[model samples]
Structure formats: C-alpha cells, structure tokens
Target chain A: IAGITQAPTSQILAAGRRMTLRCTQDMRHNAMYWYRQDLGLGLRLIHYSNTAGTTGKGEVPDGYSVSRANTDDFPLTLASAVPSQTSVYFCASSDTHSTGELFFGEGSRLTVL
Target chain B: AQSVTQLDSQVPVFEEAPVELRCNYSSSVSVYLFWYVQYPNQGLQLLLKYLSGSTLVKGINGFEAEFNKSQTSFHLRKPSVHIRDTAEYFCAVKRAGYALNFGKGTSLLVTP
Candidate 1:
C-alpha cells in the first residue's frame, strides 16, 4: 500500500548503545512526524519535518534526533539508548490536502536493557 | 498548545449495544479535532475529523462524533457496536501545525 513504512518492527538494545529507526513513505507527503507511544502517556511527538532539509523538535525531543534528508525518508536516532526510552515508536505522514489526518506506520517496538 | 483527554481508559460493552467514547480537549486558538482507531497489532487509522461546518461529523464504519464547542468535547458514538469494533480509540487535537496532540486512548471491549 502507499503509506508509511517503519523499519525494525521490534528490537532490543543494551543501555548506552545507539539505535536508529527508519521510516519511509511513498505518498510524497509534505510533513512527517515521529511519536512515541507509552502506557498512559498516549503518543507524544518526538520530532517532525515540514519538508526536506528541515526539522523541528516535538513535545519530547530529549535523547532523540531526527533528520529529513529527503521527502521520502525521515530517520530517528538515539545516541545513547536508555531503558526509559524503550517504547513503541510510530512514524506518520500528512499533506496539506488531508488537513489533520495522519497516516501511521505499524510501529517499532524497542526494548532497552 | 493543544491537549486531549479521554475520560475512560477502558470501556466494556456487549455486542449490538450502543457505545460512547468520551474525549475532551483544551486549546487556546482555533483547533481541528480527530478520532483514530487502532486495531490489534495495527497502526492507527483515521476514523473521522471535525474541521469546520456542522457540529455532527460522520465517519467510516458506522462511527460518528459530535464536536461540542461549549464543553470543549468531541465524544465518539456508535449506534450499535460489534465484536469486530473492539479496538483502541484516540482523540487528538491539532492547531495550525503539522503535529497533533493525542489522548491516552480508550480501549473498547465488545463482548458477546
């Protein structure tokens, strides 16, 4: 289908290690976002890109970084993984025409030890 | 800034019975409201949205919601729910930005 695709559907990493989650979209949407879903915190925005070559932080941006090298890819990296950072990460994309609608990926489940 | 609140963390209902999922939001400026459904082991999908126009908005799969400006609420309703409708529902709010603020989510359990 022509929607968001997230990589590393599930992973386990030791503390102090580095990890990266890959996200790609074929819809050519103008905006993409990274969000972390927790037990009772809902989904908090980690980072976002309005267009290629530009990026911005979201509600919870600490310990995480993102880059929008092109319109189709937005990768999120964790320099030093921590147990607290372990959660389900989702990548989403949207366009001006869709208004507030967001197309989400299946999600990446990461566990830190 | 925008924030969403889903009153109930979980709701239990019987099949073929009506169900209501409550959602409330807080925002300073004009806002857009949306409801999303996530089935088991799946990504979230847009159920419906309320941008502008009438207060009532109908969505896919016999789902609908009313945007109440006075109460700052956008609660979802279904005339009759089925076992297939068991899923997690989320309420989200968006301002003039590309990101959306979401609620904790409400899990609907439709039993036989």
Candidate 2:
C-alpha cells in the first residue's frame, strides 16, 4: 500500500527561490505533519494539521508554511529558501490526532544553495 | 514541554554481540516513548513504543526496550546483532496532545 507519498524525491534550489514539497497519504489519516531532518539534529516539526482545513505551526516554522485543504494532502512551502534550509523533509500521518502510530514517507532531500 | 535525549551518537559492535542504545526523556506530565529506525536513504520506521501497561515492550526484529520511570529512561536492547541491524535509531517522546519530540539519533554500526 502507498501509505504516504512525497515528491520531488530530491531537489536543488537557489537561495531566495520558492519551492513546494508535496505530500499525500492514502490512509486518510486525520493528522499530518512536516518535519525536517538534519545532520546531528533529529527531525523537527515544521508544521502540522490535525484535520482538513486546520493547520498549526510547529517548533521550526520560520521558513516553512503548510496547508491542509483535504484529508489526503498536506504540502509544505518555502517562500524564500535559504542555505540553512537544506535538509531532508519527511511527511508523516497518524490515525489519530496525536497519540497514534505515525507512518512516514520516504523523504525529500532538498539542497538550498 | 517534553524532550528526548539519546546518549550515544554512534555505536560500533561486532556481529553477534549484544547491543544497547540508551535513551532518556524529561517531562512534567506522563509521556509516551518510542523508538524508530532509519535505514540509509529511507524514512524512519517504528521499532517500539511504551505507552503504558508493561514497562518492558517488545518490538519487531527482536528488539525490546524497558521503561524506567524512576530514571526517566527507555533503553533499547537486543541480545545479538546482525549487519542488517546497522542503522540510525531515534528516541522520541510525546505528551497526550503534543507533537513528538525526538532526540538527535544514534547511528549503530555492526561489523563482521
């Protein structure tokens, strides 16, 4: 089953450019999240959505924004990419709001130069 | 707020040797603990979790962990290791309605 799908599996972007990371889940989970993983730093939540049409900012939301228009898709956007934004981004979803097991996507490796 | 700490950044062990990866967390309220494994070029997968009931929780791939409330620790253990077990392990903690807080992660390398 395609539990979670994220695309442009890898990308290289110039600083100040805008980029969007696509994420979709077939499980129809109520909650979805965007997290960035860096070397020596574990995954940090960028944004999350508890359900359709509702979004929340996470720990590191400075350069990122997310939207949840439907239950299946929650995309992250970087308005102005910076060199420090280079990292692997993962999309995860859970069956419940916060206490369910999370299923993660393969990840999108973004390089901001 | 909840935070997780993985003591080891990297661990190297010979094949067939027992291994342990230590994890600890800090939280004022009750917390849920989890262990996740990430292979090269892949997303993280759940290894095990400790929500309640049993202090010792068994997970897939012969992995197990014990929750020590007194010490605020949940250390993963495996009796013997294989090369396939080499990967990055993460420890995470979460409150009832909060986002999961993850540790930096520990890379396990099993050599022949």
The lDDT leader among the candidates is: 2
Clash pairs (backbone) in predicted model 2: none
lDDT of 1 by residue, A1-95 (tens): 76898999999999999999999999999899999999888899999999899999998999999999899999999999999999999999999
Alpha-carbon deviation at A38 in model 2, angstroms: 0.5
- Model 2 reproduces what portion of true contacts? 0.69
Best by DockQ: 1
The DockQ figures for the candidates are: 0.83, 0.79
TM-score of chain A of each: 0.97, 0.97
TM-score of candidate 2 on Cα atoms, chains taken together: 0.98
Clashes of 1: 0
TM-score per prediction, in order, is 0.97, 0.98
What does the lDDT read for residue B5 in candidate 1?
A: 92
- The digit string of per-residue lDDT tens for model 2 on A1-113 reads 99999999999999999999999999989999999999999899999988899999999999898999899999999999999999999999997754677899999999999
DockQ of the two-chain complex in candidate 2: 0.79
Top model number, TM-score: 2
